[model samples]
Target: MRARDLLTPFPTVTPGTSVIDAARLLADHDLPGLIVVDDEGLPASILPGTQVLRLAVPRYCQDDPALARVVDEAHADALLSSLAGRAVRDVLPGRPRELPVTDPDATALEMAALMARTHSPLVAVVDERRLLGAVTLKVLLDGLLAQ
Candidate 1:
């Protein structure tokens, strides 16, 4: 099957989107990550859900799982306050990871390989800079298992 066959509508956010709002979209949609689109509506980067959580959690707590337990729910919520005014672009790494973009005509196996290589949970299917949709890891796994 082709990557297009496995494609499904995926959520996207702009670089200027607030991190808190982006996190909400991730949670509400149960997505592993979001595709960050540039002003031209082209895929610019992929924001992994883990990255959002990393921003919310304290740096000290990140190194020590035990420390996370000591932080009360209120404290945890308070920690996220830092994300209030921050935009997604601000938190992105100095060098963003390469985005995994596949042609609609690409085979599922090819898309899977790209995802594995990039360590991305989803691959954007784009044709001539126009995004068709995305093929998620779950979809790929199901297709593989079905075969």
Candidate 2:
């Protein structure tokens, strides 16, 4: 099976978009995150919800005390209060690693191996360097269950 066979199609976001806007999209669509795409329509990274929460918190990284120092030791607590008030880009994890590509001709075992090696729940399906969609655990499992 290929990624297109099981991958769900979700909206894509561009780089430098406000984290607040991304969070709104997640809430409106009831999605986990948005796929950051480049101009040529390639997957760039993911902006997941939990990352947004982290950004909203007020903490001074021991090495980087800039935020803490700016807020002053007294006002730091007030500034670092809530995730709801913050932007997604501030707290999102580093981008997810890209998965290797394989043709639909590849065996199911080959797909499984790639997934395990990359530790990815999904892999992008490509043909001649074009992304068609994704193949995920749910899609693969559904195929097996049907058989």
Candidate 3:
């Protein structure tokens, strides 16, 4: 199957997109990540879901996971508010990963190779410079393993 054949519409966020809004998009769509598009509508980066979680959790909790256990549910609920004033660009890791992207005509195997190499859960399917959607790992695996 071609990459486009496996395409599943995915969400996107801009550098200035609110982090809280981006988080809502991830949850609402149950996505593995979102494609970060530049002002010109070109694929610029991939924002994996885990990265959002990293932003929500306090650094102390990350440093010592046990510290998380002591935080009450109310506090846990408040954690999300931390992202209120932040934008996607502000929270992105200092060094972004290689963009996981594929051409519309690329073979499924080619998409798989790129996803694995980049350690990304989805690959953006672009045609020339246009954003065409994406092919998620789940869809690709299901197609490959089908009888």
Candidate 4:
């Protein structure tokens, strides 16, 4: 199957989108990640849920996994509240992730290869810089495993 055939309508956020909104979108859709679209409506980056969680966990806790258990879980929950004023771009790491994009006509194997090479959970299917939809890992696996 081609990317266009496999893709499903997916939500997108701009670089200026609030982290709170983006987090909510992820939670509501139960997505592995949301594609970040540029002002030109082109695929920009992938905002993985893990990266958002990273914003809540203290640096010390990340540095030492055991210390996470020592801290009160409530404090960690409170930190998530602090993300309100921040934008999606703020959550991106210092070194940006490569945009995982596939052409609409690309084959399933091509999409799978791109996901594997980039370690991304979803691939945005774009046609001339315009996003058509996305092919998620689960969808791809379902198609392949159905064989």
**Model 2: CA > 4 A from native:** 47-119
Per-residue CA lDDT of model 3 for 1-147, tens digit only, reads 998788977778999999999999999989999899999887888877888889999999999999999999999989989999999989876655567888999998899999889888999998978988999989999999994
Q: What local lDDT does model 4 show for residue 45?
A: 87
RMSD of each: 1.5, 6.7, 1.3, 1.6
Segments in model 1 whose C-alpha atoms lie over 4 Å from true places: 77-79
Q: Which is the leading candidate under lDDT?
A: 3
By descending TM-score, how would the candidates be arranged?
Answer: 3, 4, 1, 2
Tens digits of per-residue lDDT, candidate 1, 1-147, equal: 898789998889998999999999998999988898888787888767887888888788889989989878877768768789899998876554567888889887898889888888899889887888899999999998899
Ten residues in sequence with the least summed lDDT for candidate 2: 79-88
lDDT of each: 0.86, 0.59, 0.89, 0.85
Candidate 4 residues lying further than 4 Å off, grouped into runs, are 94-97
Q: Check candidate 3 and list the clashing pairs.
A: none
- Let me know the TM-score candidate 1 reaches against the reference structure: 0.91
Q: List TM-scores for all candidates, in order.
A: 0.91, 0.54, 0.93, 0.92
The candidate with the higher TM-score, 1 or 3, is 3
Task: Give the number of the best model, judged by TM-score.
Answer: 3
- After TM-score superposition, the amount by which residue 119's alpha carbon in candidate 4 deviates from its true location, in angstroms, is 1.3
> Could you tell me which residue pairs clash in candidate 1?
none
What is the C-alpha lDDT profile of model 2 across 1-147, one tens digit per residue? Answer: 544455656576666566667767868976644566667877665544444434655445444766546665655554335544444444545654644455656566777787677665555566676566656656667776787
Rank by lDDT (best first): 3, 1, 4, 2
TM-score of 4: 0.92
